[model samples]
Target: MSRIYRHPTQPTVELPPVDLLTLLFDSEHSLAQDDTILHQEAANPSNTVNKRQLRDLVERIAHGLRTNYGIGAQGPNKDVVTVISYGQMLVSAAFFGVIAAGGVYSAASPSSTVAEPARQVKIGNSRLLICGKEHQAVTTRAAEECGLPLSSVLLLESSPEWKLRSLEGGIDVVSSSRLSWQTITDRQALKDSLITILWSSGTTGLPKGVMLSHENLVAETYITALSGRQWAAKEIEKGNELPAVQYRTLGHLPISHIAGLFGYLLAPMYSGGSVVWMRKYNWEDMLKCLKQYEITAFYTVPSIFLRISKSPEVTDHFKHLVGASTGAAPMDGKLQMAANAKLGSGQDAMIGQTWGLSETTGAITMMPKGESDTTGSISPILPSVELRMVDDDFNDVESGQEGELLVRSPLVTNGYYNNPQATKDAFHDGWFCTGDIGSLRDGKFYIVDRKKELLKYKGLQVAPAEIENVLFTHPQIKEAAVVGVPAPDDPGTDWPRAYVVPVGPDAVSEDDVKAWVADRLAPYKQLRGGVMFVDGELPKNAIGKFLRRELRDRAKREMGIKAKL
Candidate 1:
């Protein structure tokens, strides 16, 4: 029998007969009264954009894309617009506008090196690149490398030397003579359109693009919104400081990242919540904003939750929180309970955790609100979502037996954008094969380990292949292997460890290798687990493949004594 864990409170309401772009703009007047988008400026982040302004901006940008770039203007085949910027009003406008004008939109992380952006643009077939002023140089280089016209690049702000180009202003001017597009009433058209291309760092090798139709996104949005509303009802029933639960959410998560994009940004907006976006994450600034805005909800990872659980100031600040929902890595139930207690969970505030993949379009399983026992039991399969625990042979596992999870839902992605072989291999009988190993006990899903080789370091997915590729960039490195071992200090977090074989006598030291990697990769991808200079060839099997498990075990024996970075 196929097991399905449905949410108790999630209602099956009639879905709107429109696309995501239409849904955002077609809000109730009462809900749209307050500012929708907020970002940090300094100690006080008062910068905000209301719903009306967001709608107008989308219209302007859509018109500009159509008029200037002939993208998403009026065509059956929509062009792709790649956005490389921080989370802000402009980034939101650029993205929504592309979809409004019928263009495919993809957002790339600014922290990523040229290779990542290049691959996204080339594979996504993006026509125009929209970048922020700070990242103009890298964006320009990436665009040139990808053979995208420099003229197609639009900067978020105007500059002097590089010629300031305002994407907002240019679009406003172009669309001045044209009326903004009305809501697309055609439900079937909206369902069929490919609105976004979200990339995933696959289990091995380069990141693969995941194409999502507007319907796929809409389904998740509607389902997630119902859950949020139910949570608000629970908060009200339990007695909240703000009287009833208000859906004011924080958006410090990266706009380009899947967790940030749907879990924090779009999903909250869909639920009639205002998102306070931070340009970049700063612990102190985040602490200030949480209190200043009287934020009702938080979607974050366990590492930050652990930090908050320790801080009295942060704890005192979030007294009115409805809940803190965490994912991306393992969360300690005790730590979550402690954090919730501080956030006035005594008043019935909730703390939660979920398990998901980019292939499933954010989380497929969620921990029920008001629950203190995390225990990796993401409450249910959610409405219309089905789960099955299967062994390596794809046979169903017995109760309490660990097996890889297979997910089937309307929100499940169609497939990877360009990789048919991968798509074909990952799915069976309508279920998307989730590489996570877990068991279904009672009704809730309990995760144990992942069958895939992808590493999770502090809630961020760190692919060993990506780190090894960067290691190969070093001249002194001959053979390189990377693995994720438990961080010595942090109980649940994992740290990326590098094991290297030197090519010459003048080879780099451990610190040198770490520093080089730090410079090249993101801070989270750093070799905090310490780099070991291995002698002779690295551990391998008969097929001559580098054995990461041997290196991982060696890491525990050698570098496990080091203090937390």
Candidate 2:
């Protein structure tokens, strides 16, 4: 029997079975319809997008895609449009526009190499490619390699006014034409309809596309926001003064990832918040924006918080910050407390920790406002989410015992896109296997370890198997294994390190191995943890499987001790 755990304090609420666009723009739940929801940071008058302008832009882009590009001529979700760009206010338009045209949005990292986006483009069978001006070089090559014509590739420019035009200058998105997204109320259709494809590295193997639906996004947005909404209501009922903070945040993370997708695109519209877009993440620029925009709440990773705790330039930037949360990687308890101290002046602000994966859309567990936990534990499960801890035998464990955490929620992805075997392997019964080992104690959850071999560097997923596959292509490498070693400078982050048995001694140097990977993979996937040439062979078991645990332990012991010296 399984001992399932539901949220202890919060009750489940009914989720609307409408399309994502309808829920955001046309439903009773919509907020900030007449207010500014998107802003460009550092602009003189700060280019802003109200709800009406956003809807008009989305409709025009949808019409242009359908009439000019034939995106949805065959109906919805069949056409995949790939977008690669950094943070910009207009990127949200591209996202909704694709969905409004009954097309699926496929996001790729702007920092990706030619081969990376090319592989994704081929996987999705993408019909059209879109990119920001800065990434035109990489997108051009990727589109060419994918055999997509230059006419099918569009450039998204935001500076001198928002425009989506073809490189050949034949097609441009204009406001004269408009198309509205079909309002969906059928529960089954909402559950089955695919709206976005966000790539994630599962427990093992190369990166796979995670397919999310309208139901998934709606459930995630509603459940994640419920606690805060309830708290605000109760405070008002008691006639107590609430914090005088607006729902403003800074968008400094990549829009391709789940955190950025939900935080920047979906959540703000529902909460009546405003997001100030940063073209790319710069530490100094981010600090200035926080103060400049008077950002009240933000979602970031542990690495950025680590910087805030140590950097002298962090003072007064977060004085107006009332809410802060960190995820994507583990955070030390001391570091969490130190970072919390830098938040709002007279408020009882705490930097909460959230835990989830791309499979869960964004967060399954987050601490509610007015609560503080500095014990390195991810807070309570959100409303309507069910959790279970199961041992190796598939039996439930006691409350305090650690086991592989399984979750059941509408927020979980349907499965990996176009990979039936992988999808089938990801679930057991009706529960989604999270590949994380964790425990539930007194209504709070603690993630003890990752059963999966995936490593997160600066909140980006880096699969060791992906790197090893790339290494095997090198001529001089015989056998190779990769493991994550703790980064010396950045606490609570891991960098990929490789242990290699070369074909011969001195045949391949460390720089040669690093450069080989840099040329083939994205910058985040590069082996910053350095490479070591092993003497004989990598440790293996009786069946000749590489003992990665031994390598991980050795790397940590050797590398961590050396850093101290």
Please tell me which predicted candidate would have the highest lDDT against the true structure: 2
Clashes of 1: 1
* Candidate 1 lDDT by residue in tens digits, 140-217: 888889987777788863211212254333433225534365466576776666778777643245667777877777
Q: Best by TM-score, which number? A: 2
Give Cα distance to truth, residue 501, candidate 1, Å: 24
State candidate 2's TM-score.
Answer: 0.81
Q: How many pairs of residues collide in each model?
A: 1, 0
- Candidate 1 wrong stretches, greater than 4 Å: 1-14, 27-46, 74-77, 157-174, 182-188, 202-204, 228-242, 311-315, 345-349, 368-373, 454-565
Candidate 2: segments with Cα more than 4 A from true spot: 43-45, 201-204, 346-349, 453-565
The models' CA-based lDDT, in order, is 0.68, 0.83
User: lDDT, candidate 1, residue 265?
Assistant: 47
In candidate 2, which residue pairs clash?
A: none
Residue by residue across 159-215, what tens digits does model 2's lDDT show?
777899998767896547899999999998988989999987322456789999999
Q: What range of 10 consecutive residues in model 1 has the weakest lDDT sum?
A: 157-166
Q: Compared to the true structure, candidate 1 yields what TM-score?
A: 0.74
